[model samples]
Target: MSRALLTALLLFQILAAAATDTTSTRQPDLIKKGWNLGPIPVVAFDSDLGFEYGAVINFFNYGNGSTYPEYRHSIFMEASRYTKGSGQYRIIYDSKFVLEGIRIMADLQYLPTLAAEFYGFNGSESRYNKQWIRPGNKDYHSELFYKMNKDILRAGLDLQGHFENPKFGWIAGTSFQRYNVGPLKMNKLNAEPSPYDESDVLYNKYVKWGIIKEWEKRGGAHITLKGALIYDTRDNEPNPMRGTWADALIYYVSPNLNEKGKGHAKLALSIRKYFTIVPNDLSFAFRAMTQNTIAGTCPFYMLSQIVTVSPRRSFFEGLGGAYSLRGIMRNRVVADGFALANAEFRYKFWRLHLLRQNFYCAITAFGDVGLITQKTKLDLAKVPISEYNSYFSNTAQRPHYSVGIGGKLVMNQNFVISGDIGKALDNQDGNMGVYIGVNFLF
Candidate 1:
């Protein structure tokens, strides 16, 4: 045999082996929905006849001059039936407890088969500490801690479903919620005049509903719409910290302080396009969105829930982690009404498998920007920490920007773990992007 012919044959053999190795050792976890396929007893074991359990722990601590030390800890448990049918029963429980800083919650979700894969009944009780953002020892903290405990109970149902065809597919879901919000009770005024010393005080109760839908295809186009109607009955402050003493300052100065949470309806829509503009080596994607609050009101302190309020606004609304803006704080953007557009570029390379399995890697680059169109009156003049509020003052005036790079580690075809580091261009702090999570950012 000629030397050239031998070399060609060797290359062909390597490619064949690579393909065969991947196909033979593959596991059934890659299959989305199916019964065991190989042997009877073994297939039963590989099928959905077993219970599944998962847990995640997340903790974040700020080092630079935060009011006080704060930490967030949450635990989640999921239990599901072992049968394969249109309906399976599942239950999920989550608890987030903030000992010193607020945000105490317990949530339970009951998912019945046949409804929708992602639909469920969820109920939760949340107790928010009176003064969440303050600088002091637990004992020295403001009177807000003594005034009242902000309590809320929520019950709701969710629906999610998908449809598929040869060239296109779509998914949709909606939810309905009712809330009972109340204040804490206490006996005497106490020698120290704690906010918790009050009694029989009630805030309000209300209902809310929302609908969300999105559709996409094997081609490269998609559309989405989401809207909500809410009757709010909570209080707000200009700062993240809420307490009776904090409120005293506002009531003493701006006697017109708005402590009531109003009701409102909000709607948003977006359309996006994806194109393999550079063959398999490169691709491009873009999205545009518009949002408005047609009716209702929001408490000043609850501002972050209604809009994206962050040091960076451009790409703050999407999933946070290694994906999205690679290197920014989670949900760091805030605004009442805004519009946004995003562009992403991706490149892939093969032939490199670190684990000798079906493992592979790739890199990506992306940018996102957004502008706020409207908002309610924003004032931090009377705030004790006016400087922190300044960063958000003209937030509606600037178009936020970020740039970053990311990488992926894919195992089999369905399991992927990725990370990305990004930095803000105009960032004075010049921090590095940090993210770690599963699956793609998109």
Candidate 2:
């Protein structure tokens, strides 16, 4: 089907659902729930990733509404690809009854990209050269020079157990991933017909200059034991208007790949809270996060990773892009560790309630900021001043900032389609970013 037809069908289905209500009260309609399903037509774009096309299905089981907003089980699945040869296949399952007091959750993902982002490291510690990546500039290299290709297969499973207080829990999970990384190939992304100049590729240049280690140039295995102390008391898990959710996970990465005794420990923490400004019509929400490699060496390719709590449009890494510093170039501020904060003012202008299904449209104004808390180890003294002047910035370290607005189409207080436009505070970070994706950032 055409994009317009698919979108129209989704809207029609939502409206048809809302028009069947027999009463003005939302309670009666929600009380008779057994299973609720929502279909999402994914239409979004990012400058780095290109346009995306796909769909998502959210399955929710309410089981008689004893807990109005909470579901007994939820399953989410999505498949999408960008026009530039990047794609993702994902499936997630969450359930409270899967194992006694423990909630069982699993995330399976397969992602492939022809043009993954690499903007150097450590926020402003190293300068970003716009001319190098921006084609047609006097100092321009190939358009694909700054990008690399990576294929990843990853799966994670967590068994969360709660004690007497439902608000507190202990989480233990394991993640296994294998990565294959290489220089981007112009032939694969429909560039076979017309090849570009490939004499001086960025990835090879870095390797030849000793800037990128030989071992990390080609990706390898990363397996970690994940443990956390989590506290959550959100009034609504999907679109919280009140309460707080705090979590911290420690990852003990086991020695893998060709390197032994290279295992390390990493710490990640996120705290989010929401407050009602005008009941359900208006509210404020915010999230603050930090991550660090406390000991041992982290792979060069993995240095940019940010803790993932939910899905977003592009890959999750370091501090940049939509989920972290909106409007900043994807992976622009990568480092060993970083800190970030995001705040939003949300307003609901429309509500649709019909029969057992309901929907709402919400708009939000937001601000985001992030910076490298720990620098990625790099020695500039050995490198010549000319190289630093050509490829790196000579500026003081500072935070990346952005301000933006977004709106969401929410189904039954659960499935959400969100779009936002953001502008970076400095031109070095990026001029702006436009994104469409799933769920809240936290």
Candidate 3:
């Protein structure tokens, strides 16, 4: 057996032995009451972001333990930084008790990345040459060729209220976001002199060719108003074992701060369903979603942003990477509209109670696929005929596929530590990726 599987088996045996007295009876889960806190040090590594260090703390109020695993209020705080000049500081508050029969969620976040992925628009139409970044290759370019620098400051508030039927609800919210985007800082990225240091990067080339408009090249600020209709019947919020949750959202971006004439409206639809194949021990879950520009033009910088009823992570920019299509390159499929689907089988192989908290470990097998449905309009006339092939493939976009396996360790059914490894079926999407973070992909 592989070392990872062996290690997992050993861990299962150890935990089973530790809970020997409660295994047969399957002792009742401990009921938590009042205020509780779950904090974990953020120590991780990403190929693009470098080593990350910081902390994440979740504060939950269970009130009288009437809801057991469900908390009456939750506050999440995170402050972390990656070695390669990327950092995130965020605070989120969620509560149903804030208003009678209404749920409120709010968040404030600041994210800065020195190297944000920026592949050209539309999937497959933009060729991905791995040789460009290989140091010894004849076609080698700077490793940061496909990257740009970007920082975002965002704040939002959302409220959800049920109709006569509790399963149906309405959501309304507004958010303000400011983005600062530019070419990568090569001086900061390289400690030693290199041949490609002075080479023009993709972002600069796009700006020069007018593919990226000058007005939004440096980024801008905007306010978005959002409304959604939701139908939900999930048994649990963190990792549902049964039921379905679906939502249709419409959001309008107000005119940009720098260009009052620029604005757009978009629609996002998502549906997630969970099936209990073996009660609480084994389950299958799937999510289908599509986001499309309904009216008006979308800025190039904003094309990668995704809209959801409730934001789960600090950053949600992709049709790829951990948040969307696992194992594929991050933000590989940027377009005006896209459709995605993900399916996974989960098995809770072991359960135990320790440190006065309930714990369980699960293994998951999953597959993800997505494609651009509405292509972003690009003006190719400005491109020189001699260099057109380097940037455009003139081919139809197709679905990008990735398959992966993951494991999760859950504490009190609310705090989850998840790790996934995925491989892309097409080389253009990337070879593989390993992601470690909190919560499920949904």
Candidate 4:
């Protein structure tokens, strides 16, 4: 059977299971105590990254059921790889019990991508030609024309402490990250040699044109120190039905470990609100955020990352992609800074007991829009007259928008199985995207 048909069938099965013995009276959520474990096989597909395989395991400690849907301690571990030369391996630990009156979060990750997307700087300003990679087109180049190899080693620690009001908090964190970037590894992909010259690829062309600096072309290592002031009234961290959460964060990247006096400082602001439209069964949620470079210079390799006080995923590099703008191409809006918003309506149609655990099914309809707020400075003087149009659009950047639908299966209201299918409204942002993963994208 085709993947779509298989997915539909599985969804149907889940809905049927949850819909059994449906009733008007709401069932009370079963309080979870002690330690609960959830293990999910990582079987997923991404249009850009191809099929993925591996596993993700989550352990939650409720510590006497006082928090119900919230856990006192949580541990998340995943080991997954894609068929198209990408891999993610990580471990994360979070707990309120680690220190008195404080919450602690720590993570370590290694991500390797043999063909990371590189579509130049700034959204829309950087032209994307579908025909160039189309097999039968006259301008056909290699299929991997807009790709490069990149690997990241990252480790971070964050601490949060509440004020006297408890709703207000302070956050501080430090992280060490290293990026290794270069040309795509054709040998690793086991593909036949390309007929086109090396410069036919955008990365190679950019290097030759001086758009990507030689000192930072291969990537570098840096230490980042960040702090934030936050106000949170959310009832739950995983999925909040009603409340508002906002934070203002500032982070400074120390001078590049490999290059002297090369670094930058940035400011990020995020606000999220949730409204319960129909009590526990339906809700409306929205998040608005912006991140901007406030000082110094930001290298090209670091342009794609979206800094957050607490990262929800292993890869958070995008104004597009699953974590940000669902349907748009991954990292398609790279720039010095950007602004984005997400609005969604979530309706829980079914809730039931499965395998002695409380399970609920929800469907979401969401729209995402974003644009480059601070453009990356590019020196186009090096561009040849003949190739200027192909490399640059010379157009103003505008908001890229997409709309999509998603489904979720929440186990004990903590562990979530989620999927979304989004379509970009503009052809410049590509077509559509299908994502299957964990947690709500907040």
Reference-based TM-score of each model: 0.43, 0.90, 0.94, 0.96
Off by over 4 Å in 4: 1-8, 11-25, 190-194
Clashing pairs in 4: none
Residue-wise C-alpha lDDT for candidate 4, range 1-442, written one tens digit per residue:
1463366457659656655433255577779999999748457666668777898899999989998788889999999998878998999999988799999999999999998888888999999998776766777777788889999999999998999999999999999999999887766665334566644579888988999988888999999999999999998778899999999999888877978875799999999999999988899999999999999988888889998865455238987888999889999999999999999999988787766677787899999999899999998888999989887997877999999999887888889888888999999898999887788988
For model 4 the TM-score comes to 0.96
Q: Looking at model 4, which ten-residue stretch has the lowest summed lDDT?
A: 17-26
Give Cα-based local distance difference scores for all models: 0.31, 0.75, 0.85, 0.85
How much lDDT does candidate 2 score? 0.75
Better of 2 and 3 by lDDT: 3
Count of clashes, each model: 27, 3, 0, 0
Which RMSD does model 3 reach against the true structure?
2.7
Task: List model 2 lDDT by residue over 1-442, tens digit each.
Answer: 2453356457757575656442233333345267788766667676567778887778888887786567788888889888878997899888886678878888899989888887677778666667655655666666665678888888888788877898998888888888888777767754321134663465666666777777778888888787888898888877899999898888787766566558778898889999999987799999998889999888777777666444222137647786787788888888888889999999877666654566677889999999788887765554666766766776777988999998787777777877777899988787888777767665
On the 0 to 100 scale, the lDDT of residue 352 in model 3 is 80
TM-score of model 3 (CA atoms): 0.94
Which segments of candidate 3 are over 4 A away from where they belong? 1-25, 191-193, 197-199
TM-score of predicted model 2? 0.90
Q: Summing lDDT over every window of 10 consecutive residues in candidate 3, give the lowest-scoring window.
A: 1-10
